[model samples]
Target chain A: MAIYSYDGTFMGLMSLIGFLEDKQINPVAICDKNDLVTDLFEEQEDIKTDEKRARELIGRIVDHICEPAFDRIVYGFLSQINGFEMAIFNYLHLGLTAGENVERLAGDRRVAPLRRLSLRVGREVHRLKGFVRFAQLADGVYYAQIRPDHDVLPLLAPHFVQRFADQHWVLHDLNRSRAAMYDTHQCEIVILAAADSLCFAENESHFRDSWRRYFQTIAIAERKNRRLQQQFMPRRYWPYLTEMAERVR
Target chain B: MILADSAKYDVSCASSGTFRQGRANTLGNATYSGICHSFAADGRCISLLKILMTNICIYDCRYCINRRSNDIRRTLFTPAEIADLTIGFYRRNYIEGLFLSSGIVKSPNDTMELFIHTLKLLRHRYRFNGYIHVKIIPGASAELVHQIGFLADRLSVNIELPSRQSLAKLAPDKTKESIIVPMRQMAGEIEMYKMEKKKYRHSPNFSPSGQSTQMIIAATPESDYDILRLSEHLYRKMNLKRVYYSAYVAVNHDALLPANPRPQLIREHRLYQADWLLRFYGYQSHEIVSESHPQLSENYDPKVNWALHHLDFFPIEIHSADYEDLLRVPGIGMRSAQKIVFHRRAANLSRQDLRRLGIVYKRAQHFITINGRFEGGQSSLLHSLLSERKIERARQLHFDFNDAPSAVQPSITGEL
Candidate 1:
């Protein structure tokens, strides 16, 4: 009957899970430090992050379970859902105990929540890959902004790096105040301020107007299903889209 | 906007089935799993910058709004202008690639030459490695077609009407031979290039994504059976990647065309479903629609209708049935069937196991028996239940005009 709290980073969480497994002690709950509720009778443990220990734990999981299970754990952490740390800890506990056959227990109640949360995060990552719209800055860098429901900036870097290998781009996650900057050779994540003073290229609005005109013209009058359109590209993403900027005007 | 609105009648905007890895010093690459950058209000995927190169036409096709007789403003984008626009849009990730089509300006060769110039500028000058789909004007010479095919990823030649008689009545300028000859040539060249690539590792790919064609539905008297058979022939004989069905939009009024045209979206949807059956489900066209039944029933889907007509195939044992047999059962798609085969090897499956595999057990319960026990009703009761579900689904498919807001409606002039 003990609760373990970590520093809310993925490395910190993995280190705490590694320490618990080494001690062979199961905690009643695992959460971030901010989510801890003080109880007078319950015992609480504060775990510090160890980079080497976290790397070794991730390598062990990849060796014992599967690579996809490792991805699932990372996605679940990125989901930032309440009580997701415990769900991931339980999923890893089952995987380690069940050996290589843990994937067969996917339908089990203990592992289903982790799968669902990971799927939701994966869907948001896929949508942002398509929904991200870049505007040319005066310095010849492609600049785009997104306000996603989950922290998906880490998941979007490898994709854009492969696709836009010849140009410099910056993708800002406005919700989290983080940005992924790519310099045609490497990508780095940094904290960025709001882009109120950023100056765009002179012809940026002209190209945006052309895209808006094309978007408005291609839809057929005979069959208009705005509900379906909104279902795929929700209104929350409209602020950054060049085609939707005309509607605001 | 004028070019895109006029080009909306053409419905072959697919950006999938091609894989080109991103290279250094290049802007983008194409993946097998196509990315839809946006969706139109018509519920269709917007994967490409679908626009016409020029809207001024020499032919007077009765169903087209850009015919010579129409009183509409005309516009033409030069090769440099088109090249710049496509590059600008691609950099912003607003589109997967460019879908370039044009109306006949002075002659077929002249129009095709313009398309070739634009493709050359995009592929050579700008060094764009993304997906590009170009339309082949009918009656274009072989030299021009080959040059265009070498640069573009996919090519298409629209068989505007289904039959020759319909073409003669609507578009007198186009003949059946003019369209079919170039299609046959492209197919032959594609095969030749494939063989050449095997011999030489770096032989240039010819239409690596393959060619596709479009047919307007409800404009002519062609039945669904005719369209399915034509699609079957194109897939087997010409090796087309896709066959798009566009419901006829009556933008122009003429005596030869229908006075009041209705866009039969359900029929178009059903045709796509049947097309999937032909391409992926390993079902022949004759099995789905025969000469006796020349049309698909609007009440039930083609797969369910086939299952209902052949009642002897029901009640298959879930444990012993083959993969193809499992596919024949309702609610078992390609992925679920694969999952069933994979999961059953580890454990004997039950009704709960089937549900966990993502099978729609409500529809599948009537067709499968778990461990030699049937949970479905008698034949008459089962038939009634399936029919009731079908009727409910059909009613839900109809869109209510009153429920939609007025702001979303298209203007009376058909301009956005």
Candidate 2:
């Protein structure tokens, strides 16, 4: 049995899938470079990221399977779950063999786990779109920080670009040390340091105080259900939230 | 703090069903499916910055802490302050928009003028294109209401109580005609604007999200039947997008009002479920609640109650039943019904297929049959099994705030 290892990028994983298809070799397992377990008896192959091969695989998936199904594959890859690369590879394998009708096979064990993981990634993206709080910097740039479980910076750029089109803003994902910066017109991703030294605009605290005041005051005392609150906006996200920051501090 | 805490009793914080794309040089956009920025300790959604212009009031309502007689701190936000705050918050993506409600200061017209002024500054000066929902004081003039309607995305006039008699008893200053006239005028203006948009593409949108109203439940002795019927009337006649039900939280001590009143959350939840049935599931108010059965069953959900009562419609063939019939079943939701319709074309759906379609088979198995074979056991056994699940759910409904994790402690003292 052959074990294929690649760099933990979506492009690298896609290239490995492409290589597997070209070589007609079904791997026993696919692991990220960090997650590789050394086994003396097993054969291991290291796959490098090939942009052309990755693009070809994406084109094939979009043409053979549905477009949304391709989106699910991307979302599933973004989820960063263990063994998800192989899960997505198996799902694509099944989809290619079964043709367009593979999208309807929800009950199939091979496709269901990938679908569920992609759904989770989609839900996290949707939640972060609402939960992201931007604090204006001294330079008039709206700076916000998030620590999402998955790599959602790529998914969130287009939304903020459409919504806050006229403003310069930076959405930093602290977990990944990556930021999506939009300078009123275009958006680009860059490596950003931890945002501890940024100077906020004057009166930023006043608006944040008012928001915290509003958040606190708007909850009915008689129906206080912190469980439900934590269920929707989990406690782990409270530190970055302006309204919940005071409590955490 | 005082304004938002007092306004907390007014539950209508949804910022959905309106689509406004961000324009060039504009600040923000509004989505049709609203985004909840956060959830409060009470488990309520914090979508809009729901606040009041001022907490001081002239009218003395029995259920209000902000009544004329109540001794509470009074503060008002200036039009510029409101505009600045809304724009600042919008730029940060902290809220979908603003839900601006206010207490009647000197008169309805005076208070409405303040709202209109604030809206003007936010719209014209700030160039804000986000969702804005403004409340119309009941006695505000038609011209003022129309002017505000054109500026705001949505407008609402709170019919605080369900019936005219209840309004007279609890809130003596508000009359049924005074509250409803603005609603009717706004509805007419909305219809006219839709027609005008067709004629002239650049016709300014007039309350493009339409109007909605809130009714305080359990404040009076009105049953669920009265509330649902009134909601139906509002939806059918006034063209209301939503009818919010706010469970009464006793804030003031009055001889007429009940002392230490409990917020009927279960009843409110049931009413919202029944309202969904009325709006989406093709069920009428009277069908869900009748004069004979004036209240929804506290033990079971309204859908299950309806399904149990109408056993004659049971054993619906999974393949043969149409979309409407599928929705009528107890455990089948709207999405599952649509999924079944889409899936059955490719293959015959079995019990496993129904389960995979996300149907609650524990409840649906009693009502549905696959290939004319009943997977559920005897009728009595199925009933007992369903009842057991209902009782388990009912037990879980008593949410103790103390049991919540320490991360979400009640830090705000504004709530009464």
Cα deviation of B339, candidate 1, in Å: 2.5
Model 1 agreement with the true structure over B90-156: per-residue lDDT tens digits = 9999999999999999999999999999999988888888899999999999999998889998999
Index of the highest-lDDT prediction: 2
Candidate 2, superposed: residue stretches over 4 Å from native: A5-8, A19-25, A33-40, A45-50, A97-100, B195-201, B378-416
Q: List TM-score per model, in order.
A: 0.91, 0.91
Model 1: residue B394 alpha-carbon error in angstroms: 7.4
lDDT of 1 at A105: 56
Local error of candidate 1 at residue B221 (angstroms): 1.1
Tens-digit per-residue lDDT, B212-247, candidate 2: 999888878999998899999899888899999888
lDDT of 1: 0.85
Task: Supply the DockQ value of model 1.
Answer: 0.61
> Which residue runs does candidate 1 get wrong by more than 4 Å?
A97-101, A245-249, B195-200, B347-353, B378-416
| Residue B363 error, candidate 2, Å | 1.7
